[model samples]
Target chain A: MPEPMGFFTDTTVCIGCKACEVACKEWNQLPAENGGIRELSGDSYDNTRRLDGIHWRHVRFIEQFKGPYDGRWLMMSDVCKHCVQAGCLEVCPTGAIIRTEFDTVVIQSDVCNGCRACIAACPFGVIDINPVSGTAQKCTLCYDRLKVGLEPACSKACPTDSIQFGSIVELRTRAQKRVDQLKSQGVKAELYGADPNGALGGLNSFYLLVDQPEVYGLPRNPQLPTRNLAKSSSFSLASAAVLGVLALVGLRKRRMDDMGGPGAGGSN
Target chain B: MSDTFFSGAPHWAWLIILYFFVGGIAGGACFLAAVVDWFGGPEDRPVVRTGYSVAAWGAILSGALLTIDLGRPLRFWHMLFQSANVPALMFKGWSPISFGAWAILVFGLFAVLSALGGMAEEGRLHNPALRAVGGAVRGGLAKVVGGVAGLLGVFIAGYTGILLSVTNRPIWADSPWLGALFVASGASTGAAALILLAPGRGATEQSLARLSAFDTKALVVELLVLVLFVASLGSVNRVWIGFWGLVLLVGVVGLGIVAPLRLHLQRRPLASAAKLVLLGGFLLRVATILASEGIERYRVAAGM
Candidate 1:
């Protein structure tokens, strides 16, 4: 009914403000993190443990130092990829995980049976089960907000507009242009989850990375669980067939052995 | 053992390995039932009936374990009611979960019918309608239902491998052979479990021996594939060499494929050795998956 919407996260411009996180919590009514305590993570300013049921939008702070230059703080607001080939969607048994008309992945919380298949299937460790609700929870890309003709809360609240939201096609074009701009400025910025042929058939919400994806806790190659299923099923069937034949032969042999015995024959 | 641990592996990798372990157990149970049912012997019917019941229950339980690990457990139904995403690798055009659910339902129904049939034949149930239902189930109708349910079971069992292989993760994605590996592992474990569970008798012993031989053959194939996969990783992905090497040498050879083979060859009782092998196989899968996760993490870290 509407254009396919998605997120274009430009990691280079992210300031790690985490306003998006606050906005998401406010809009979605998610609970406070660690009872809203101000504790340092020792790793960075990212006190939030990680993406879980309560926290949908996470700003990752990666501290890096290159050559003799002063160390730089890389911040990227991360959310669900809304992958074109979502593993979570495939493995979910209850039909709770669904793709919206906007081509974004969303889980129907009401219908979910608290099966963690999607959590296991997700390559990025983005999804989690809500301990409180006993249901799988992740960023819905603000499906509820989208339905009312408004942008996602996180995108709207981003101070630097790091988490951009718009049509996937338009976003891709904008992302490519941003990458080109970064390259012109001698920055080695590349797009992760951009190539459709790449792992997971690209993501509806892709990223602009200054370094490798793993530095941002992204998997280099995210496989689909179903691919392995087809191959294993065929082999299993063939093995079973072979076993079945052997069993039949064994049955025939047993029958013959019974017939050969003196007490085997009886009046019908 | 310290060297075997891959520091880069995340929590999800461990979770997947657990998933595979449970899935294999469930699938193997069903396979064992099928083999026993097809091959007649003393107590074969009882063995077959028990195997099916265990498998049915085991599958549901394993599925539950997987569901418990999800972030949106309440949204589990979206996999069935929502529009299927054909292009997505994980998209079950018709939810495999739904298929598995139906399979369990059918198998449970069949088990009840068969049990009622036994009761009717034994003069426990005198009602004519009950007898009729039992008779209908034992007739041609049972075969059709069993066939459909069996087919569904196989799919559910095999789908786990496909789910892993479709990812671009090099350690897993490199092998177009994972599916076969999963199937072989499932069957081997299934047969071994049945052997261990079935009552001891000369006929049952002989049946177990045959099943063991079949399992051995499947294990050999799995071993070969693991070797080939590790060897290929030497050139395909250098990091995988170390990670998968440990997995192959320790996890698969030492634990899964070989250790049980050794036990069986030593003339140990079927129950002990079969259980050992099944445990080993489950460990091997978990270790391999975790190793793959580590390698992937390393690749990402190194910007490869």
Candidate 2:
């Protein structure tokens, strides 16, 4: 049908104003944590710690300051990656998590039994249980808004245009250009989850980061759950075979012991 | 970012853990029953019946526990069928849970059939029609049904560990030995269960003793596999540094594996050893699941 759409987050220019997060919550009708009560995280200006069930968008504030001036602050708005080969979608037994026509992963709350398979499967720590819906919840990349030709609320509210949403192809070209521009300006700019051939088959919602992926709570080499499937199953089968042989050995040994002493199996 | 938690907890809690425990035993017991039915003499029928009985009930309980643990328990059928596309079977070869759900379901079917056969052979079924069904299963079809059930049982016993290993969790994904370890533990616990329950149902002392011997070996194998599993974790094995570690050491290793071994060697009552093994099996699931879920809590406590 239609071309796939996604987000290209330029973290280098994020102001950490959290306008995008507020807009996302407002548009999604998501409730505030602890019933609108506020608590300090003691980490930075960020109180919303990370993306979870309620918070579809999290603005992470990282301070790499020696005297608050020598180093720089790295602010990132983290959300679900919506990978091309999404771990959550791959492991969702209920078929609740589906890839929309936009190629963005969305969890169908009605269909989700909330078994939490997606929670364990997601490498980026994106999916979590919503207390209200009692289902695994995460960013849908504003599927409703996209269906109506409107942009996602978070990107729409991003005054600095840090979180840009558009067709995947156009976004990739723009991201590469931005990376080149930043590199020319003496910045160590790198594109994460942008290459179609890369990890998780390249995240539909990718990012441009100045630091290592781990520095942004992202995996350097994120793997699908299938990576361990064959090895684990093979080892399990071997163990089963050993158990079977030992069981037979136990039976034969007992038979021999009985035959040596009284009578074979007591003959009762 | 390194300070942050890498993933969300499944909140599997007690229900899923209990399911793992019972599901393992069900699969193990079914396989053990198949072994006895094929190898043991006519006198060992009681033990085989006991195995089938345990398998059937264990599979049923595992299913119930898994269903109740879901967010929408009524929608548990969604696991087996695509609710969006009615009547379309939901099966994901790549998803362990999907495979597990189908395996448990199919295994339950086989377990129930075998148990029915055992019951009819024991002359417990009164209805003529039911007896005929059970008699046919027990007579001509017993070997084939038992073989298939036993194979599926082994899969069921080990797949839970594989399920964990396939996840992004710290200690779970770190090891490939969980499946082996879980299977070994399942065998031991299943044997222990039969040893405890088979008596007075007509199990001979010889058969019981042989099962005990098998259980002892299974415990040793489980112990070795567990060591490898923990070792495979490398520094991530530190997840067992606190309360969970104590459970693993005292409950799983000392009481579950070692004490039972000691009892078996001393020729003490099989019941005593069996109880200890059962307790250990339960605790193993608890320690493995909760420890990973509480990894973040432990990390903070250790100043990590």
Candidate 3:
């Protein structure tokens, strides 16, 4: 629906401006949540720090040093990936978290029980509970704007077109061209979360990275928690089965004592 | 190399820890009682009564803890009956929390009924009608209810572990062994609860010995599960092994299992060890939840 809206965040051109963050807060009508005041993070201009309950769009500042003087500041504007198999959607008990018509994940505040299940389930750590609303909140990919045939506020406000919003298909074509162009220019450019075959079935909001994905604080291999369900469930069953055996041992020992045996269980 | 130490975990917080503790302990107690009622015979009524009462109370406590901790405390009905729900007996999806709620609620109800079945033995229900209520729940009915409650109790014990394992956090998702660890710990709590609340007042030396022996077995299970859980985490990160691991080792494994085993072997008063195990239970839950700090707490990372 709606041509599978998505965001192609080209961190290569990002200028570390707070415009995306500001636009997100302004458009979503989110309250000031960075310690309830305009306080600096002391970790450079990354004052908002992370994607959280309030701040959906975060500009990550990764200052890397190769030597005493050789260093580079890698700035990337990060947002929810809106994964195809979103862990948050999979774990939300109340079904409050749903993939939108545009294939972006959105949490329904009214239906959210605020058990914070999604908070942990989200591999991206994008979803958080609004303190005031008492519900899980995350980037909606500007669901309202998408409905009205407009772009997300963050992309609209991005001065350098670093954050582009449009059909995922179109964005992928553009992102691939950019990656190849940068690679030809000797930039060590790479694509992250772009493949539809990876664990998450790919991200609607993919990224174009200049360095390794891990260098940007992104997981080298992100996966849904459900992947371990079979293994984990099996372990639990094994545990319960062991406990059941112990319960048998307990009952048997008691029976022996009752029948006037030597009380073997008394020692062990 | 990543510069930040952000752990993308959950914000389960204190209330949830408390809920897990209560739910585990309660489920354990109920399960223990159900076991006794179904199979322990007439001589084991005291332990059965104690077990049922503890389970009933535990179920009630957990239910309250969860509801009050919820963001939308009033809309519990949404969890119980929505398009997603199948009414009171509803269970859909891998939402272990919702399933746990159903298990605890149902287990609590059965536990209460089972506990009431013990009322006739306490005397003073001379009002023929009231006595009949108690009498009806006795005998075959008690066995059926106890059997069901016991099974639910076991589920309750392991449900929290399953819930945590399903999350993407490595400390939690690292192993399925958490389920085993929880069930074992829960059963230990059940024995400990019975030892604390109803310490065999007219219990035969034989019956007391039996309970103690069974508790030792429960401790054995607990220690084994802990070992399995730790083994699964094997060399991930020492940050957790340093603090939460220490808590699991000392607070749970040492205090919970070793102390009780020693106390039981010496034929000494087990109240101290039982109390220690109870305390260890709460500490274990708290430490695990707090351990999520580096991963999912107030930190920043590249992406999920």
Candidate 4:
């Protein structure tokens, strides 16, 4: 397997230019959203709403303006985390989704029956059905590019150096240093999904956020779907056991009723 | 997009919901047939036969509904075999859908065999060779096949709920009682279905009374489990407090459980009660699935 590669997106440096989104669509041959017809959302300049099947990379424009220029407009370029413990890969019944040699997850389109089990299992809400393909799809973290020793299109197109792509080890070191620098400047900067010991086993594509994770539509603590499986199955077993005993008791009661009464066998 | 950040529900609409209902009956009927064949009197043969027939046909319908629900129906076989690698069957124990696919296939085999055996016992098979095979299934080997199939049936009934519970969907993942609730409901619905179908097949008044007795107990258990399932949801229970909750309370609880129990106690017609029970079972699945889907939509609309 190749060295584990990933993306470290620093929201502080992101210009919200949407260059990464355009680069991803162009390189991936992804169809334009709503047939390329742009509509003013009135929320901000962000017409492209969220990351989905067609929109692999989305630039969120969070307008936190008080009066005029008091508060800051936070911008975060969201993409698939390519989580170390991917819920989508885990719940896929067809084995269509696989972890690539680069340690990034990829869905084999030809094999996907589009059951959409992965979509519900995903805590990140990353996977969705591609209308044209009729199969669940999301960012592959540029699996095609990584195969030939190339960086991902989104990262390559990012002119601000906000979206850094490199070996996981090197990126973590750089991210920590940046976090320290920002903290010294009192920016309240922190790294999300950088710790390898975290709940989702840490994400390959992590983020550097200035505020709470929820402000950017990210879960504070995402979990795998299988976390509740054992408990659910246990309760099911107990219920089945109770029902079995009830069946035997019902049968016993019927025999007694038949033996004692004169018109017991007559149907109602 | 939603407040939960979920892109959308899995698009598991009517087809999947129908499968859950049919699959429950198939599993429950097979289990009842096995129990009757093993423990009940010989006079219960008609009930056993009807149970096996329901199990056989219900299993087939369940399989069909599941396959047709897939986005690519032609690739339904991918659930069993790994399409990326030919000839090698795929099995993931951690994945409920993987385990469920295999369970359905195996349970279908047993259900069909039992139904054929019951048919042969009634002298329905014309061919001597086919009759002989059916006789073997119904003869000494009957207990073995029914026993295994009964257990698998229970698994199928409960596994469907477990399938929903292991998702990020709001109400689905919030509580562990979905599987328990489904199992109880499966029993009640299974008994109701047999009660409806048994009389036409020459079921004895004694056998019908026995089934009615069983159905009553199952309904009580179902009612109890339904309460526990809702109560366990905590704040997630808010998602079902409106129209969906009303359906669950009135349609499922009052009409489905209470009405059926009242009719049975008052010595009213069993068929009417059975029909109501079946309706209630379908409504339960509808309420659970749509409410979760609606919650996801509500979250997105509310915005973070």
Candidate 5:
């Protein structure tokens, strides 16, 4: 009924303060820093142990450029893409997961039977089952907040406005402009998940990246599970048919043998 | 596992495991139905009737498992109710899975009717309507129902493997033969399960042996494909090599092929040996696929 809502993540401006993470926790009433105090993961300042059920919004800090000429820290807050052709949406059995009128993916916790289907179907590894609730939970893109006339908590709390929230069309335009602006500034920035025709039908929440998507733990080509369902089923059916024929032929031969070479039953 | 190697294993891997698990159960039920019908036991009529019913149930269960894995489970009906994009590898459509679902429903209904007919034949019910329904099911209709269910189950089982094989993941995509291998594995596993569950006899043992033989063949083929796939990678990362090699040996060679062979050769009872082999093979396939993902990730990280 309303204009479809989405996220436009401009990674170039991300300062990696992780305020988005805290904001998400506060708004969603999620636990802050799983496994007690946050310890350094030894990779970088990232100690949140990757995206899980509780931590919907993860601010990844990737340090690159070994010595002197290449010293830059890449910072980006990642969340569910809420894909148009969402694999998780396609695989849920209990109707627990739904695409809202906002066009964002959300799991109804009350309806979820802790089946973990959405967890497996998500290509981004974004959705997970909360160990405590036994139900799949992820970034609702602040569905509750959006219901009221307010922006998502993460976007509001973000000092740098790296995680921008808006309509899908506007976000794509903004993402492209941001990439162009970064390129003008001599930074080779690119937009990810903005191509509506791309794999997974592009994302409602897209990204701006300085490096390859794989570096940021993103699938280069995400696919749906139902794609090969037919071919696989055909193969299975063919095998069964062959088996059936063989069984039938074998049965007929045995029956003939039992009937005395098919002549004993004839009373000519 | 090394951080680099284990990094970003996709969620599809787990869903694939779930697919194989559910499909295996369905395929097994179908094979049981065939075995029961082929050999006339005191419970043969009931077994045959229930076998189709169980296969139908399995198909429905598998479908449910698949749906649960989706991000939007509510839109699952779109695959059935809407038009599908054909060329897209993940295009939701009237696929074998969907067909299998339909087949399961149809076959299940007929099988239930046939079972009711068997009960009627045994004088368990005096109602003429029930007898007339049973008589209809017993004459010509029963075979059609069994045929359709068996066909659908076969597809459901084989497709699980082909789905992975179609992926560009080197471990799976390279092997065109993997699909056939999966079908054989499904059939063998299904037959073995059915044989075990049915009353024990020498004939059942022989049937199980036949199923085991097919499994052995599939294992050999899978092993060969694994070797070729691994060798083609050509001096991959150490972690990738070790992990995949271990998987091939233990999962493919040990559990899928050798365990069943050992059980058969040792002259253990059909039910006992079939159960062990069936369970072992199912686990082996799932473990192999998961390990394959791990290996692929390792190689990717190593830039090989």
Candidate 6:
């Protein structure tokens, strides 16, 4: 309702410094994800692998060698999409999850029963339960900072302009212009989750990617799990109704059989 | 496209699986009792009484399992709180889990009342005051309560699957028939429980033979729904193929269904079939949960 503030991440200019990661952890006062010891994952220089209860923002380093001379490193900063039709918010058994004024999803930790419904409901696998707190955790888009007119820590700490934060309309315009500029220079730039009509009703935080969405571990077409509930509930309700009717009918047949039997002074 | 991203499986563990199995059995047992009350006369009172007690006890056990699954066990009351629409108490209440909470509570209460009515019918209650209460329940209220509990029982059985279907995970959302399948299995297992408690050789054989006739039909329907559920996933490029799959195919479909049919046709003993169906009922929940393993975060494996 308040202009729908969000982030538009352009991976082309990302430096993959992970300064945003450190800044997020520091600002949020999050504890170590794996007991504080840093390990260089054999995957790449990206040690902090994926977003979990602790890591809300992750910098991914993708290395490719099309042919020794035709190689490039694809760097992307991944964060919660803050989807318009958030599955987590929809499936939350305790109304602990809420969609904020800025259209970002936030979990009220105190109210959460830690049923883990939201964790499974998340399409992007964004939410997780912080072991210590025993409540689901995910990117709130810096709800505390946004309340006081401050940008998210990750976007503020980004070295390059890869992560841009502002009103949804303004960011969409800027991202489209950047995509056009790159295409003119023979770069295959496409905006993912920018179209409001797209699956999941688009994202408050979207991306500009150089390759297929799968290359970045994003769903080609993310869907709201709630959309499937209609079919499931309907089929089930029908089955229950049909079974209940047949069961009742069976009861009637038994009554008639009893009445018509030899004990009732009738033929068996 | 070749990039890999690992996603952790859902947070549910053994307790939730236990809840599903226990709740399914309870729901099924109550449904059978409701059927007998609606149609059968005094002759079926013994089996009907067992159904009532089993449903009541099953509801209590499953309720305990649900409570144990919660992280803040003391904060369980938080589920019943409706912060946004308190004024609409009749229409609007808690979330889905909250609705389930009240549903189970009501079902359990009715089941207990139904059992009391049975006690009165059999002249089992001793104290005059307790006998009076049982008398009132047996007169008419017990039928209404059993009928209401039956509806709630069916709801509880299917809603478990609906609860899982609401998750974005593919293994859950893949099939719209999970609830239908679960209910059918619930009914079959409930019948098996009754069979296991059959009185003696002569009466037991007749009762089991009739139940087997009904249960085998339920099993056939359950099998058909299982196929429909798996077929629904065909377009998604996912298949149930693993240790759990074998358990479902062999343990549930084979032993639970085929063995029961064989014994029922031969008029032979069905104690083994009863055990197999009960075990299969629980294993079915296990198979359903395992189907979701590595469903997400394995984006890299499928080339996303």
Which stretches in model 4 have alpha-carbon errors above 4 Å?
A37-44, A66-69, A255-268, B1-7, B126-132, B297-304
How does the DockQ of candidate 1 come out? 0.26
Model 5: per-residue lDDT, tens digit, B5-40? 322333555665755765665664575465546543
Cand. 2 Cα-lDDT: 0.87
Which model, 3 or 5, shows the larger DockQ? 3
Screening candidate 3 with a backbone cut-off below 3 angstroms (N, C-alpha, C), the clashing residue pairs are A123-B304, A124-B304, A217-B302, B7-B294, B7-B295, B7-B296, B8-B295, B9-B296
Candidate 2, residue A115: lDDT = 91
Q: Per-residue lDDT tens digits of candidate 6, residues B145-232?
A: 8888877888888888877776666657767888888888888888888777645312234445556656766777778787888777
The candidate scoring highest on lDDT is 2
Each predicted complex: what DockQ?
Answer: 0.26, 0.55, 0.53, 0.57, 0.11, 0.46
lDDT scores of the candidates, listed in order = 0.65, 0.87, 0.77, 0.86, 0.62, 0.76
lDDT value, candidate 4, whole model: 0.86
* lDDT per residue as tens, model 3, B1-304: 1111333555677778888888888888777777767557577778888777778888888888888888778877666665354454435557777677677778888887777777776773687886887678876777898889888888888889888888777567766777777887788777787777775534445555666666788778777776677677665545465777688678777876788789888888867777877887787787666775556433435333
TM (chain A), candidate 2? 0.95
Q: Candidate 3 lDDT, tens digit per residue, A1-268?
A: 3567899999989999879999999999999864577877675767776788788898988888799899998989989999998988887777788888899999888778788888777776677778878888889999999888889999999999999998888999999999999989989888888888875999999999988776676777777767667776687777777767666667776677668688754433
Worst 10-residue lDDT window for candidate 4 chain B reads: B295-304
User: Candidate 1 at A29: error in angstroms?
Assistant: 2.3
Candidate 5 lDDT, A28-139, residue by residue in tens: 8886544568666565677764677888998877667689896888777988889998866776544567899899989887656554545545666677767677677899
Off by over 4 Å in 3: A34-36, A67-69, A256-268, B1-7, B83-90, B124-133, B200-202, B241-245, B294-304
Error of 4 at B128 (Å): 6.6
TM-score of chain B of each: 0.74, 0.95, 0.88, 0.95, 0.69, 0.87
Candidate numbers, best lDDT first, in rank order: 2, 4, 3, 6, 1, 5
TM-score of each: 0.74, 0.94, 0.92, 0.94, 0.72, 0.91
By DockQ, who's the top model here?
4
Report, to 2 decimal places, the DockQ of model 4.
0.57
Model 4: reference contacts kept, as a fraction: 0.65
lDDT of 2 by residue, B1-304 (tens): 2212376677878888999999888888888988888877788889888888899999999999999888888999999999989899999997889999999999998888888899898899998887887888865488778778888889899999999988887777878888998899889989988988899688988788778888988999999999889888877766778999999999999999999999988989889999999999999999999988875422231134
> In angstroms, how far off is B36's CA in candidate 5?
6.5
Clashing pairs in 4: B2-B300, B3-B299
| Poorest lDDT segment (10 consecutive residues) of candidate 1 chain B | B1-10
Predicted candidate 4 versus true structure: per-residue lDDT over A1-268, tens digit per residue? 6899999999999999999999999999999767878686766788777776798998988778787769888999989999999988998999999999999999999999989999888877778888888888899989999999999999999999999999998999999999999999988999999998996899999999998877777877888889889999999999999999988766665566668664354332
Per-residue lDDT of candidate 1, residues B66-133 (tens digit): 55555554544444444354333223443444555444455445545544543443455677898876
